[model samples]
Target: MGNKQFSQAQKLTILKHAKQIGPKEAAKVAGVHYTTVYEWKRQLKELGEEAFLEHQPRRSGRGEKEITPEQESAILQVWNDNPAFGPGQVRSQLRRQGTTISIRTIRKVMEANGYTAKQKQNQVSAPERFEASRPLELAQMDILEVTINKVRVYLILLIDDFSRFILGFRLLEQTSVDEVIQLVRRAVDQYGKMEELLTDRGFVFYSWRGINRFEKYLENQGIDHTHARPHHPQTLGKVEALNKRIKNELFGQEHFSTLEQAFSALTKWVEHYNHKRPHQGLGGFLVPAERFHGQEQKALDDIANSRDVTAQIQDIERSIVNLVLAPDGSVTLYLLGQPVVIKGGSHV
Candidate 1:
């Protein structure tokens, strides 16, 4: 039988008949599938007859658009800000901005604006993923080769496995063992020493014959060096994915005439990736910086409570020397020997 649209009254009648003479018999009598009868029963039981009134029948030509002009404008603005974002990312961003929109509506807006392209879905089964329990527990290091202005260059990155945070990165003329060591040392200096370091079996990282300088440095720092299986890039999937993202979002979009320009652009892109961009791996709401700084739980709690988590004092005019809380529950600030009183009571 062809697909039929049933009114709420007709659905109620069918349900009544189904109650009298089983679903299968009712479906046979009504010329509808038995499963459809059961589904209608489920909807009626869970949501009452009003659910049928809200249901829209499928139609041709994209059906009726429900997004408002303001919503469409917001979606387009988000796309303009970050052209690399897909519908899911756009939805996440809008949610962060206090605007909850559906992924379908965002995708429709993108398709209407000619900002979306057909992408082939990957069919291969993904390997089992693993992550460190805490930040600085393990760090993954990798090097990506790129040609900038016809000059061969390498981009080395050290990322925290737990947070997927880029601890340190550098663009070098060559992938030397000393440069890799320097990168690791800088990362260690900035964010304590990692318990373990993971890398692929590159000559700079591993020694086929004897321990390389990089391996020796890790040993001196009391960090265990772990190498990925030979010929398996998925072993270092996090860093590999970051390399691909950099290629697509940074290199593929802009043309650089010098390594300096490329390095500057990479620095800004990495900042955005860590602080601003919503990472899908981190539940598509928390950024890597929050996880790295141990603020993941607080951020999650704020989001759950429907509070604005992005509210922060970006700049302060005067330097804060000290904050004093009075016995009467008032706050006083001492800035350069000048006192400023901030009321303690909640504001309406």
Candidate 2:
């Protein structure tokens, strides 16, 4: 089986050559293995005329084709759930769902459906080596810039490295140390704190001088703050990819008049991303919630406290210097969230 498969004419030539000289010497001259010549000699001995011919009989009753309509349906279901999943991942999903299919079959099914071009990208670059073992064992945080209807937005996102869960995200008009700290605070307060936080060496997340607000907040909360190597976004693969998709799906779709509006919309989107969206990283069957917590999913009420957590500074002396209220007695006093006050000056 390891021999270079030769044509019928080539096989006959090799046998004739081996007969004129010796099998080993003929194999050496032909640049083929001695076993190859010996095997051809054996075939010629057994089949004589048929040995050199190309045709072979069909294989015995190949049990109900390995790939069936039912199996194709299962493969399609996996693709529908997560189009980004490759054949290996599809095989993994099939195994988990009590079926075992080869990667070749999965590719065939996907390719038949015209999905191979997208799924089969050149894998010339080194693959992502970083991995997180559990929900809060490690988390990745990053900021992305996106333009929405010509208005630029900065998105601060925190994702659980293991679950591919968007732990927290905010679409803001600008980036600041305060906003990033608030983002981390929201993640900690809701997800019960991650052990380690991975991020790029941005001014907001890191400081060349001893410590910054984000670093200080991490120390206070007992979360280890780690920075990705300068140009290595693959170190934080989950959040980096999440940011790209968010820009296309959320920021690309809507036009927001205010940062507050973007924040509210992002909150809803993040909620769905965590609770509803299935991730191929988690085998295309489980959402981030199901991956993080087996059989349990976090409700909107639980994670939605990010707004109740804080938007900005709250003290009247600190934040109300430029106080202005709408006719409906509504005002956003803090960076934290929309804190409304009545005309009489009491909080609504």
C-alpha positional error of residue 249 in candidate 2 after TM-score superposition, expressed in Å: 3.9
TM-score of 1: 0.71
Error of 1 at 73 (Å): 2.4
* Candidate 1 local distance difference test against the native: 0.78
Error of 1 at 87 (Å): 0.7
The runs of at least 3 residues in candidate 2 whose Cα sits more than 4 Å from the true structure, single-residue gaps closed, are 1-116, 119-121, 252-265, 296-348
Model 1 over residues 27-127: C-alpha lDDT tens digits? Answer: 77877655567666766877777776566556633423444658878988988888899999988777766677788778766764566465788779988
TM-score of 2: 0.53
Best of the candidates, TM-score = 1
Alpha carbon deviation, residue 30, candidate 1 (Å): 37
Give the per-residue lDDT of model 2 (tens digit) for 1-348.
Answer: 123445667778878988899887887776665545665666677787665465352442331123566777899997787555677766655554556667766776676465644446677787557786545768899899987657887888888887787777777787999988888887767656677889999999889989998799889887888898888778877788898887777777778777777788888777756665546666554557655653322222222332211111111121212233657876544221223456998764
Task: Give the alpha-carbon lDDT of every model.
Answer: 0.78, 0.67
